[model samples]
Target: MSAAEELEAGGAPTNFDAMVKDMVRLALSSEYARVPIRRADISNKVLGERGSKQFKVVFEQAQRELKRRFGMEMVELPAREKLTITQRRAAQKTEKPSTSSKSWVLSTTLPQAYRIPSILSPAKAPSSKAESTYTALYSFAIAVISLNGGSLAEQKLERYLARMNVDTQTPLGKTDKFLQRVCKEGYLVRTREVDGGEEIIEYTVGPRGKVEVGSGSVAGLVREVYGFGQEIGDSDLEDDGEGGIRPTQVEQSVKKDFEMRLRRTLGMQPLRDRRAADANGVDAGAGAGADENEGRRRSSRRPAAQSESDESD
Candidate 1:
């Protein structure tokens, strides 16, 4: 503490505040004393037990300086208080993250326009009966494929949605509708299961579906088996470099014309999985045969040694 400051304070015992005042003066005197606030330095470790509260003081002082120098307020949000899709969509219309105290949004601008013409126009209304039928059929398709380990099932789907805290039942129905429309327009081929009791149908990803779903430049089953890049149009689809687009789109962007153009060139023929299973079986058999032959050779060798010993005796 400064002697002058002590005298001004009527000789009150010197405290850390006086020390901070001195440091501030020194910092002001030296241009090299200025430094960007390192987030790590403000952590508890560097601050020490008694000094733990020092960061808060430094932070407040920095905040005061910033406000004074720029005439602006600093805004920060906790991780969980981040943005939502609907909120993001609404914000994007103005080309800005929402300044609402309730919203802490992130923004991304698109580099190109790959808009398909039909998706831009309003879709024709289908009869309710047709919608229900399509929904049921597609749901069945999803369930069946998922049951065979082709994709995630109901349980996984529910868990995923819950983690994201997204309950878009109406939007989910739209996904079913989009899948159904693909099934209708694309050259989907159905084949009987190897067991013959029921058929397992695999939908071939056509060219239109490729443009709609696949992240790659090529079309067909590759896209269905693989996936597309992120940031299609204005929103983000979960791209795992595989076909399952994440955070399913609320609207179907690929039109019937594009969907129809995709040819069903794969997944219709009988699956060749049996070849893999057969090869595995053959390898197991070869190993077993070698073990058995080795045992027989050892037994024969033992008998020959016994005979030779008996002759020597």
Candidate 2:
């Protein structure tokens, strides 16, 4: 049946299908821009003025359509900012703020096996030079802020950026404007506070930032930043069972400093694991040598005993 026929067959909502299509489109636009999609935008742009109450149904349909067609789904973002001390105390006497920001960011729904580099690598993704620069800058910024207890002083941030030759200007604009654009796009949150008469500015990951380039993603990238050198480790060698050894070093990233520090603090296990097979091989060799020596001694004693027996006879 045609859409008109379907509508005539008692589809109560007048523009439900159109709303769903619009919803998907708007969501894709927001995702491509690397910004969070808000419910208000959906109510106004996609669902029309009267359709504000149809958020749940429209959202469900849009999510299903996105997953089916694009292998992506919208994830509800957490609160964009933490509650201040005063706000927290005020909330104790009244209704608390919502855990969700009533916004969403699109994320992949594809299985891990299907997300290889050739299929979805950064090189393959469509991006302009400005977008690429913005992504790298924000990703590094977020990673730094997260690693540094989820906050970094503005001065320190600038220093770090300066070290990377980002002090004066960037693809976006001057360094300050570049940082402002990142904050404006919701990739990072910048706040000012006064402590002991010192006005300090700090940067933290924002809702869109956390959802898109989360800590896990940052860590994955960092691990590949400076991979292990050509130096072989115990893990490289494997006995072929027939006596030959095989070298297996699947290329992988290794931040030796972080790894060693973490390992030493936690379990103290060396990065290169000692092979039990090699130790067992040494033990077996010693046992075989001992057996040969025993056999020689036994043969010598037997000759003497045989000679003595013959003499007695």
Candidate 3:
């Protein structure tokens, strides 16, 4: 039944508007710390006794208001990681992994036109270096973990950060505390394994990190750090006929190959121009000259080869 119908058939009357305001307040409170708001908290705090039967209506209405007013909406959290062997076994038994975390986090609902960095840059509200430190630590840590094939051993990760001088004197406190903060904030997930009394700790991208600072975000950081797709420090140049690297050939080689190499090194997908080329080639051979048709047929085998290469990898 609809919310109005439920209220009309009700025992005690619910203040629907008040409940929606409470839901918005609760979501905003949770979002201030970038933590998720639990469903139970909503049921108890936002819905209360009278609105319990109208929870669905109340939640949807609150979402619409959030999007309309704040340009954000509460997004349901993905399922918790199945870390233990028992959890994996249970998933296998069920033939489907668990799909919900019973929690929601506020995510931007802004239109693409308004989603640029210029429109969404941070304001001066941090008030302290430590707050900015928290942001930087998680962002770089998540990028490092993502670029390191989805997980990094604790020792290796610490070494990487240390090389960049992110140790004891970091604005956020000690290195250990920095790591603890990210783990607690759900930007990184830690797993420990014990074998022969040797404890190994590893870090992986947490669900929050994936949703916020994913591979695309990582790539954006890379492009902003280095000039877009350019090789850093040294160009991987091509040799011309005279046994010297030609700048013209170097440009073509980098254009065709450097991006793929960079993405491979960073564990990201290659640039997407190949897809556009493929799309443009749809039945294109029918209208081409004999020489062009020959080249087109030659190029057509490349996709098949690429498919096999991807499968092997």
Error of 1 at 5 (Å): 96
Q: Give model 1's TM-score versus the native structure.
A: 0.19
lDDT head-to-head 2 vs 3, winner: 3
Model 2 residue 124 lDDT? 21
For model 3, which pairs clash? Answer: none
Q: Model 3 reaches what TM-score against the true structure?
A: 0.71
Query: 1-313 in candidate 1: lDDT tens per residue?
Result: 5443443466763443443343333323221221212334334323445655565564444334433442222222111212334445665687655443321111111111312222222222354444444333333443333224333333444454354333344333544344445444321212222334643433433222221122111222222332432212222323666666555444334422232232122121111222343466642213221111111111100111111111110
Structure candidate 2, residue pairs in collision = none
lDDT per residue (tens digit) for residues 109-147 in model 3: 554344543555443455445555566677788878877
TM-scores, each model vs. reference: 0.19, 0.66, 0.71
Off by over 4 Å in 2: 1-14, 83-94, 113-127, 167-169, 226-313
Q: Which candidate model has the greater TM-score, 2 or 3?
A: 3
Ranking by TM-score: 3, 2, 1
Clashes of 1: 7
Model 3 alpha-carbon miss at residue 15, Å: 1.3
Q: By summed lDDT, which 10 consecutive residues of candidate 3 come out lowest?
A: 298-307
lDDT of each: 0.30, 0.59, 0.62
> Of models 1 and 3, which has the larger TM-score?
3
